[model samples]
Target: MFYAILAYHVEEAVAALTPEEDAALMTDLLQINERLYRERTLGPAARLGATQDACTLRGPGAGMVIDGPFAETKEQLLGLYVVDCATRDAAIAIARDLRRVNPTAVYEIRPISLYLPGVPFPVTPS
Candidate 1:
């Protein structure tokens, strides 16, 4: 089974991190990512851009294009990780590992119902 680990964090809190602090956090995260990659369980993982640069399209037809994100929650969806796991417990364990490094952030784990691996794109690791 494949799981989607949605990472959420308060935008203000994340934006408040100093460059050094943010780099340190990314280093910790990359350590775990490296492990996953070695284990061949890692899939598509991405750290999304800030919501201030996001836009939304709603309603019928072409819909109304609006600036900003779709939600007004305290914590915005900051990033995501897709991993192959045998069970939900295993997925939760991965989330726990991530939480250990990012204690203030929230990780929502959900099984992927369907996945289509389209054309792959070269991604430079952050």
Candidate 2:
């Protein structure tokens, strides 16, 4: 099964950290990412730009394009990963590992479902 892991963190909280603390956090992140890549558990992953750089489109007809993100939340979504795991428990384990490095970070794990006209969905993990 494929799971999407959403990672969230408060921008201000991160900005308040000292340069050394930030470097340590980044090093921890790189180590975790490297391990995941080596294990082939990490699929597509990327850090998103700040919410201020995001824009939203809404309204009738063609829809109005507006500045800012779609949601207003204390913690912004900082990054995500598409991990292929055997079960939900396995996915949770990955999240737990991330928590060890970034205790303040929040994660949301959700299964990925795909549909095709003729392709059959497999019962096993990919």
Candidate lDDT values, in order: 0.94, 0.85
Encode model 2's per-residue lDDT on 63-83: one tens digit a residue: 989998765678988888888
Q: At residue 58, give the lDDT of candidate 1.
A: 91
lDDT for each residue of candidate 1 in 1-126, tens digit (9 for 90 to 100): 999999999989999999999999999999999999999988989999999999988999989999999776789999999999999999999999999999999999999999876697797785
Best by TM-score: 1
Give each model a TM-score.
Answer: 0.91, 0.81
Q: Which stretch of 10 consecutive residues in model 1 shows the poorest summed lDDT? A: 117-126
Kindly state the number of residue pairs that clash in model 2: 1
The reply for model 2, stretches above 4 Å from the true place, is 59-61, 115-126
